[model samples]
Target: MRPFAVNRIPRWISGAVLVLWAFCVVYPVFWSIMGSLKDNQQFFNGKAWALPKFPLLWSNFSYTWETYHFGRYFVNSIVVTVGSMALALLLSATTGYVLARYTFKGSGLLYYFYISSLMIPAILTLVPMFFLFDTLHLTNSLTGLILLYAIGALPFGIFVIMGFFKSLPRELSESATMDGASHYGVFLRIMLPLAMPGLITVSIVNALSFWNEYPLALILMNDPGRYTLPVGLAVMQGEMQYRTEWGPLFAGLFISMVPILLLYAIFQSRINEGLVAGAVK
Candidate 1:
């Protein structure tokens, strides 16, 4: 038999495919950054593929911050994201710990019931949620938004943290118990520290979800001052008119994305570690 080339396809074709994938992922970020430097005239008249001839970053950033009152929106987003994540972490950590460490009647049934909630579409519950929140006068408040976000985030956080907690060694807790540590002490000093990566992962996931939340925020918060970034940005459009104010719009969007991106960059290793830890055991 003649010698066969195992790789028959051209290397350049594979390279081209990889390049295309990379471009697909990064092109939007690049375009947004470039658009933030272009004037209204240049944004439309100039080629979208081309970079700005004159970068007006300072003016664009200033306009986006001032006109959109993005500072206030940013603070609101931070508060909501942080508060929701805190609540999510607390609830998830406790739930996961209980499910993992104990063997009680109906434990499996309870876990199944909790996980089943994730199957239902969040939009389906919006009416009931809104009615409940309205009844409590939680409508149009930051606390209401945080509470709503935390509730929505709970299922996934509990699921993810449950996997991590289940993967943990029971021997550690056994040792803690031998040393006379109580259930609360073992959880607080041992389990929690060991599960830090999972907690951080839950926090990041909940924060991102809360930051990008719109539908609930739209219904709950009527005040413009309490608007998160997504809501504030949506209001920037004027009466079905497509204004070519790409500079400020892009600047606002770019700024809005920075915190989450930075967070992912900083804690990416921990996220990966938690994922691998969960997957292995």
Candidate 2:
């Protein structure tokens, strides 16, 4: 009914932008898949985007595993990411709830201080954090990585969860208190259940980041066996520089992404709910 709504040029431009973005994402994935099927020689000779002309080589996965110690790396990544996400969510939820529900001196200033970290580039703190971790003997330890990741993820997680908690009806907590429920009981039983969607969103986002983290792992972790998947892949490429085994490299990259995809698939509904909740408030 509106003139702008009937505008063809705006619709066409928006549609074109989406198409371009889709191509940018899809083409690389398609190329990577194609590359995984081809041997090194075939990858070099064949068209970059075309599928392998020969039967798919299943052995690439085996070679990738044996060569890179990928299994160990994958396990380490999972352990670190899951551990960090759990700690971060637990801490962030408590902090967010306090900020959202309580009115105290400098609460606004406290939140400003917390969320301000998000605006700072991570690279700026990387060196300082590394130095501090070294002083505390946290370098090259999984425990150290987990702690740093959890703390680093806190700002954004708290911001998002705080927003969600603020949007919640305070009457629910009041009602629970009227029934003689303690603060812990109200939070643990009532508020947490309602905040599950936001927590899931934060968890998924943090997990993805911790899983794929490269620069931090590269700086902190020195043991080859303790390397996370991203660092391991980098090491693999470095070790295999002469041969350039695109097949296994692509395979490893594809496999590394599987867990994240699975997490998204499983918690997809909650993730959507959290996104909508954040936007609505």
Candidate 3:
């Protein structure tokens, strides 16, 4: 069709680059799966890239699940992630709608406050949060982490969801109002559903953040029983100095990876759609 399109060398080079990138991304996951089925000796002695031999060790998963209580950690992660996403979405949707649709005194200032807060690093507040959590008896509390995660994600959520709201035509709201829809009805029935792509995008963002969150969870959760998956993985890694259970370690990692990977894979298109709509509108 064109010089660039017909150029075989460039096409070949581009294909090569893509293949290399794909391999780089895929190999680690492949290796991890293979490694999860191997003993320490097989993992070390066999070719690093080789698939596990027959009689694959499924015991690694069982051992990690039972011994490390990864099942507990998995449940904890799900609770925190789902709770945080739900809370954050509700709060962000309401706040973003109000900020985006209604203009009153200090509205701009309020939006800017969130913008500025988003820029502030989370690490800077860790010391303050530690003391505050202790004072409030929130340490090692999953509910407390849910609230914190929701609040921590609020700024970004508001930023994204607010754009979605702003992009929506006011005619939809005005017409719904003319039909005797209350403000809440208009928002719930009309505006919210219209913003589904944005909501999915925001949920995915918060889901990933809360699921993989490390430093905050690590610092706030003191009780081993309360550990989220990331913290649990860290605890597992820490045991490596004393016990190098490579199989179980990879199994733990793979377990932690599954939900987030599946989530992203399913909703990734929505993310792109929402972002593009937000930008365009």
Worst 10 residues of 3 by lDDT: 272-281
TM-scores for all predictions: 0.89, 0.87, 0.93
Candidate with more favorable, higher TM-score: 2 or 3: 3
lDDT of candidate 1? 0.82
Q: Residue-wise lDDT of candidate 2 within 1-281, one digit each (tens)?
A: 65665578888998999999999998887887677778977877867777786688877887787776888888899899999999999889999999999989998898989877777888898889889989999888999999989999888788889987988898999999999999999999999999887888888877878998999999899888779999998887886668678899988887787887798788877666555544453
What is candidate 3's CA lDDT for residue 137?
95
Where does candidate 3 stray beyond 4 Å?
5-8, 273-281
Best-fitting candidate, measured by lDDT? 3
Count clashing pairs, candidate 2.
0
Flag clash pairs in model 1: none
lDDT of 3 by residue, 1-281 (tens): 54554578888998999999999999999889888998999877988888888799999999999999999999999999999999999999999999999999999999999877866899999999999999999999999999999999888889889988889999999999999999899999999999887888988877888999999999999999999999999999999999889999999999999997898788888766655543442
**TM-score top scorer:** 3
Ranking by TM-score: 3, 1, 2
Q: What is the lDDT of candidate 3?
A: 0.90
Candidate 1: 10-residue stretch with minimal lDDT: 272-281
